[model samples]
Target: MKNLKLKAARAAKDLSQQDLAAAVGVTRQTIGMIEAGNYNPSLQLCIAICKTLGMTLDQLFWEE
Candidate 1:
């Protein structure tokens, strides 16, 4: 498992975890877990997150 890049991007956009969770239709705890690398979301959830954040899945989850 790897760390999510969400925290940095969200901070850059001035979005709180709760704000992102609401945008992606998930719980704040879910976002927290994702950020903490404690949860792996389904493809649909991943897509939702990427879409809401104006990023690609690779940008958020993949490492070189």
Candidate 2:
């Protein structure tokens, strides 16, 4: 499934894919792929992304 929550959180934080990727030490395409559900990020990467966005892993990566 698409990670629309991730996309929305990023947008609410005013971060572009490139900005988020740079903060998390990944490529912009990686961020895009995550949001598109084409990529499954490592736990380390997920934590990095959550930190950069001021979110928790559960808030950003968990599915209900």
lDDT per residue (tens digit) for residues 1-64 in model 1: 5454888888878999999999989999999999898998999999998888888989998877
lDDT of residue 26 for candidate 2? 96
Q: Which stretches of candidate 2 lie over 4 Å from their true place?
A: none
Instruction: lDDT for model 1, please.
Output: 0.88
lDDT accuracy of residue 59 in candidate 2? 91
lDDT tens digits by residue: candidate 2, 1-64:
8999899999999999999999999999999999999999999999999989999999998999
CA lDDT, every model vs. true structure: 0.88, 0.95
lDDT of 1 at 9: 83
For candidate 2, which ten residues in a row score worst on lDDT? 51-60
Q: Which predicted model would earn the best TM-score?
A: 2
Q: Each candidate: how many clashes? A: 0, 0
Q: How many backbone clashes does candidate 2 have?
A: 0
**Structural similarity to truth (TM-score) of each candidate:** 0.90, 0.97
